[model samples]
Target chain A: MATVASNQRGTGSRLKTWWTILKISLEERFVYRGDFALGTLMRFLPIITQVFLWYAIFAASGKEKIEAYTANGVVAYYMLTMISRAFSSMPGLCSGIALQVRDGEIKKYLIQPIDLLGFLLLTRIAHKLCYYVIALIPFTFVFFLCRGFFENGWPEASVLCAYFLSLIMGFLLGFFMEASLGLVSFWFLEVTSLAFVYNLLNFFLSGHMFPLDLLPDWAAQFINLLPFQYLAYYPAAIFQGTIEPNQVWQGMALEACWLMAFIMIARIMLNRGIHRYSGFGG
Target chain B: MTGYRPSYLNVFLTFARNSLVRDMSFRANFILQCISTISWTVMNIGFYLIVFQYTDSIGKETGWGRNEFFVFLATTWIINSLVQTFFMPNAQQFSELIRSGNLDFALLKPIDTQFVISFPRVDWAALSNLFVGFTLLCYSLYQLTTKAENPLIIDWRSILMYPFYIGCGTVIMYSVMITLAATSVWLGRNQTLYNFWFYITNFSRYPMEIYKVGWGMALWVFFTFIIPVLLVVNIPARIMARPLNTMNSQMWQLAGFAILATVACLMISRRIFVRALKSYRSASS
Candidate 1:
């Protein structure tokens, strides 16, 4: 029997692997610099229309408020949404693996004695983190433009620090959820369509384009019941200082529970997935 | 650019028919995709309308009403969709073909390779997106423009300019895509760049004026001369209505710009595509 490295799941080892994966992914992305930059530039288009619509809404309203939000608040909230996405966790990498495996390439991965999930999570997270780091330039530029319209909003250091921690936890939960979706590809060959539905559901629930608070009361409550809020709104609300600090622990507790649950699901899936593992060996 | 004589219309028919037949082979997938696209389009448009319904007018401009904005958004998007259907996919696929040493097979085929490669695939489902876009445009136009409501006839100039602008728009889009895909020759593959292109399809939905003056001018120049996205919808509509004096001159300059860009880029990209094909040393023995 081979040595299976029982203690390899320690945080330090995982961190080192994550760092290496990030470096490798960053190198891969560096080759497509122009495309990445252009994509960053292209992303501004929808926001442009959004800003225009807000300008119109302001014009139409004759200085009115919808619920608790003023026109400026709505714009700020959306801008915050964009910023949140730049930092939000990525979708699962299993979608790519699903395709890679179907093409019979996953066999190469099986020979490695190291933890596969660690490598998968590390590399995918690295690419997104780096992509967002590059993406931050534009996100900050827009935020600066947007900040001019808002009231004073640089939060206190302690609250801000708490928000930052919550943000990281939020990202981890979101990553775990999406990565689990990718892991599902071990069984399903065409997860693309499923991914579409998954992302669309997330787009609405995660409060990406609109604040969940803006949804009808019932809809808002329904979405809150799901885990998507921890993906975006929890962190965004903290940054906006709209959410209270006492609530932070509640949110974090929920995030921890879901993270634990999803990690178990992933472990189960990985184990079961190996039994039916064809490794493109059909 | 020497070539054996080939019937232009026949080439198109063959390509069109082949794509149609191939797509028909997976009839249910095509229908499902159509339904998916329709729902997706409605969701997007609904999101805009929700925002619009809550607002008085965009830009705080007196004349730029909500319906007009929707009309503007929808019309341009439809034309953009048509261009996407025609050009964007092929450009993306062509880049892939080059990367895989697959372009060599196309060059071997007894046809004008460009004609064959450009229209060899079809997604008729996108046609539903076009219909939705057109219907939304018409509905919004009726709400905004009194002339349309009164059944007053369109001026010859406006009618003529509509198709003319579409032609210019196609040329502009084709030029941008052709060049972007042409990067495949140097970059090994540009599928990542392809991701950038589709995401920007939302840009032309708003009038260029919403951007501050300097940026607006920059957009006019870039979209007009380079990407030529404006000719797809905005500038043409601007010409039709004589919305702004500056816009009228822009439409003409844009058309001329598109023609020049198309000829120049097509020559360069084709040569590069050919060169890349020659560069390929297959991994297989």
Candidate 2:
């Protein structure tokens, strides 16, 4: 009985520690409110170019639907991609980890009681929360302006639930995958080029550039086997109602599986990296 | 000391040599960066190839057929690579120089401040993009001449004009970039400089014909007459790929305006840069 009570107390204190980290991270994010808002709005500017390009292409093709996507559907897909990317993108996370490892800042995490992965995950969550809060108006305005493009209109409640669930899984998957890549810095000492290559691949394969279905059938099948699609494409396709209902659940399960695998990979890398680390300066 | 003037050519050569040495010192990084850049270009080509599978041209009678569009893409890569290799790294560091008071040292030097600031760091790895662009351009030109329904006539006039327009495009882009960098002197930290650069340059990547309709017309007008980035690749690509007689009178006028815009952009950017320098409050102060 006494041991069970102590275990409960320990869990409570752990939650409190995470709460403090989350609060501080949120505070840091909100410090530059105006800049944050402007940055978010500026991100949407590229979509204008996209809309024109697709419009021109569809007009040239003289097709109501090319590759099973109408002009409106393609535009709507891109808009949804922005939302998915907002949840999954981890700017500077990889480089920041490399810097910490190289500069001996990782030593602090060793001495502290905090788990490095948990801390990073919490900080990222706070960042996303702050981004959504500040970017709510811009997002709403953009979506409202382009509402006509959404020919299918609002999705069913069950699909909507699955869409949101897939997005949450995507967030986790993106974090762990990037964290694993970052932890490679322990051995490499410099991962900038590697990170660049990874980002280039991610940008294309993740459907941030265009829909995966645009690729040849073989190429699409090959890329779909990889985890990159979960980053942006899967959630957007879910919202577009392109995937069947059962397939949506299957995709969610697959995404969850990838997330778990990446989590294990990150934890393993961190452990191995810590074992290899040696801080030089006193 | 005041009478001794160093030759600018010699100084530029020295900077180039020094930058090459620095780049070679990090040989692995240089190789990896080159690989990364080439991979990106390949992927970009692949994406466009997939897009073109569904259509004959980029727009309705826009004349940017597959080979013609590849010419445009290659031109973009060429101009972008030159600008990035020579100017981007230096311009990016302009704000840092102000913050660190390194601009004081630059000002104390006997050479032209702008020249020194712009040419000190040459990212040699970026030259890989130039190589890839040239290769693609050559292959696409071959395809146009031999395989297309109407074979392109490659004339000596176009052969000479292409490089000249590429030079003009590079200068105009550099002018825009340096002017943006100069604002860092006043803004103290222009962290959004690269983002703004990307957003502006993204428009130039596609053919300008896409912007001829609807609200896109507003953007076309703004970026063309006001900023004139639209002419950077469009004029050169059109000149190379399309027959001269087929070019509308408006295109000829725009081509003429490109040269004027190049000179005007250079002069205006120089003025803005000097004015911004005058406003600089160095870190020591």
Candidate 3:
């Protein structure tokens, strides 16, 4: 009974530390309030261009539905994509990690009581929370203006639940995948070009440019098999209720599996990287 | 003031040569950057290839068919590559200079401050995009001319206008970037420069006609008249490809607007940079 109580106390203290870290991160971001707001709002500008591009395409086609998407349906897909991207995107996460590794700043975490991965993940959580809080206003404004484009209106409650789940999984998967890449900095002195290459692949494969369904059958099939689809395409598809109710479970399972795989990869890389790490200049 | 002033062209050439030496010092990194940039362009092409599969034209009424659209894409790559090569590195480095008090050294130099800040470095890897874009433009033009339908007449006037328009586009983009960089003086870190840059120029990547409807009409007016980004790519691409049904008068008007926009943007950005410099207290201060 005493041991159980002690274990509970340890877990409680750890949670408190994480909470404090999150709060401090949030407050730090709050200092840059104007940047936060403007940055969030500016992200919507590209969506405006995308909407215009899609409108022109749909108007040209003169089809109510092409590739299982009405004009409104396509716009909704993009809007939902923006939302999913907000969740999945980790701006500067990889580069920050790589820099820390390269500059020997990773040594501080090793000597300190803090777990580097846990601390980084918590900070990211705080960052995302802060981002959504400030960004929710602009997001609401944009989505409200685009309300008419959602031809199906609000999706069913169950689909919304799955959509949210997929987004969360996507966030985790993206984080771990990039974290693994950052750990490669233990080997490569400069990961900037590699990171850029990674971003290029992520941008295309994650369906930021267009719906993956629009791709040729074999290409789409190949992309679907990759974990990249979960990052943007799958979650948007879920929000649009384009994924069948029966298939949603399978999709979520795949998302979870990808998340687990990435987590393992990140852990293994960090473990191996630490053994090879030699601290840089004093 | 000294009676003798250094020639700006000679100073610029020296900066360019020094940057080349610096880049080549890290040969593997240089090669990697080139590879990374080329891979991105190829991926972008693949994306458009997929999009074009769905529709015969971007806008059926506008006649920006696949080949014409490719010309526009290539033009974007070319102009963007030039801006990225000549100006983007310097603009990005401006913030770092501010943070590290390196701007003091730059200010101490005996030359035009803007010229010194704007041409200190060249991203040679980005030149690959120029080469790729030129090839793509040639191929797309070939396809357009061979078509049995109304083909673009390659006149000396348009041909001469194209490079001028491209130059104008580069100047306009550089102005926008420098203006953004200048904000670091007052804003301290100005980390959102790239984000804002991406947002502003996103309008330039597509045909300007797409921005002619509903809320997009507002963007068309704003980016065209206010910010003048729509003029950057459109004027050059339209002049070069002569996409079907676009009038020569419209082309001339756009060309005229682009030239005016370039001058206006440069003046405004220069004013902003000077104002921002006045506000600078130095990193120590």
Candidate 4:
């Protein structure tokens, strides 16, 4: 009975620690309200180019649909991609981790009782929450302006739930994937080039540039086999109702699997990296 | 007062040599960056190849057929490579200079501050894009010439005008970038400089003809008449690839406008830079 009481107390203190981290992170993000608002608005500006570019392509093709996507549908796909990317895109996470490792700042994680991954995860959650609070207005305005593109309107509640789930999983997957890459700085001191290469690959393979279905059947199949699609394409596709309700569940399951795999990989890398690390100089 | 003048050409050459040495110091990193850039270019080409499978041209009656569009793409790379190599690194560092209080040293320099700020770092890796652009341009031009369908006639005039307009494009872009960098002095830390640059330049990457309809027309007019980024790549690429007879008188007028705009932009940007310098408060203060 006494051991059980002690375990409960330990869990309570750990939760308190995470709460503090989240609060601090939220405060940090909120401090740059104007920059955040401007940055968020600037991100949507590229969609204008996308709209025109796709309109031209569709007009030139003289097709009602290209690869099962109408002109509106294609534009909608890109807009949805912006949503998924907002959740999944951890802009500086990789570089931040690499800098920490290189500067021996990871020493704090070792000395402290808090788990590094948990602390980072909570911080990212705070970041996303703060981002949504600032970006909600711009997002609503843009979506309203582009409502015509979303001809399908909204999916049923079940699919919407799955879509939200996939986005959450994508967030976890992105964090873990980038964390793993950054932890490679333990073995390879400079990861800037590697990070660049990863970003380039992610931009393409994740179907951010164009839909994966636009590729040849074999190429599409091959890319679909990879986990990068779950980061951006899968969630967007789920929202678009391109994946059937049954397939949506399957895709979510696959995303969850990928997220679990990445989490494991990140954990292993962190353990090994800490083993290799030496905290020298104050 | 003793009359003393520094040779601008000599100063530029020294800067270039120093940058080359610095780039060479990290040979592996430099080579990796070059390879990465080339790989991205290759992927972009691959993307367009897939797009062309669905359509014969980029737009209805726009005349940006596959070969013609490829020429335009190559021109973009060439212009972008020149800007990135000569100016982008320095422009990116402008805010850092302010933040670190290093602008005072730049102010102390005897050379023109803008020239010094713009030319101190040349990214040698970016020249690889120039190489790839030229190769693609040559290949696409050959394909257009050899094609049985209304082959492109490239004459001495085009050969002369293409490089001239490319230089004009580079200058216009440099002016825009330097003006943006100058904002760093007032903003204190213009972290959004690159994002803003990318947003503006994104308009220039595509064929300007695409923007001639509906709401896009407003953007077209704004970019073409006000900022004139639309004229940067469009005029040079059109001169090189688009048949002369098919070109409207408006395009030729726009070509003339591009040259004038380049000079105007440079003078205006220099004025802005000087004004921004006056507003600069050193970090020490």
**TM-score per candidate, chains pooled:** 0.77, 0.98, 0.93, 0.98
**lDDT-superior candidate, 3 or 4:** 4
What pairs collide in candidate 4?
Answer: none
Candidate 4 chain B least-lDDT 10 residues: B1-10
Worst 10 residues of 1 chain B by lDDT: B239-248
- The residue ranges of model 3 lying beyond 4 angstroms of the native Cα positions read A1-9, A279-282, B243-248
- The best-first sequence of candidates by DockQ reads 2, 4, 3, 1
Backbone clash count for every predicted candidate, in the order shown: 8, 0, 0, 0
lDDT per residue for candidate 4 within A1-282, as digits (tens), equals 998998899898988888999999999999989878878888988888888888899999999999879999999999999888998999888899999999989999999887888888899999999999999988998899889999999988998899998998888899999989988999988999999999999999999989888999999988887889988999999889888887777777777788889999999999998999998998
Compute fnat per model: 0.50, 0.83, 0.83, 0.69
Tens-digit lDDT track of model 2 for A41-141: 89988998899999999999999998768999999999999999998899989999999999999999999989999999999999999999999988998
Q: Under CAPRI classification, how is model 4 graded?
A: medium
TM-score of chain A of 2: 0.97
Cα lDDT of all candidates, in order? Answer: 0.67, 0.92, 0.86, 0.91
Q: After superposition, which runs of candidate 2 have C-alpha atoms over 4 Å from their true positions?
A: A1-6, B1-3
lDDT-sorted candidate list, best first = 2, 4, 3, 1
lDDT of 3 at A261: 88
> How would you encode candidate 3's per-residue C-alpha lDDT over A1-282 as one tens digit per residue?
998998899798989988999999989877877767777777777777777888889888777787979877887888888888888888898999999998789999889868888999999998898888888888898889879999888888988888888989989898998898888899997888878888888889998778888988998889887888888899999888777989999878877888888899888888899999988667
DockQ of each: 0.38, 0.85, 0.72, 0.80
Off by over 4 Å in 4: A1-5
Instruction: List pairs with backbone clashes in candidate 3.
Output: none
Assess the local accuracy of residue B54 in candidate 4 as a C-alpha lDDT between 0 and 100.
93
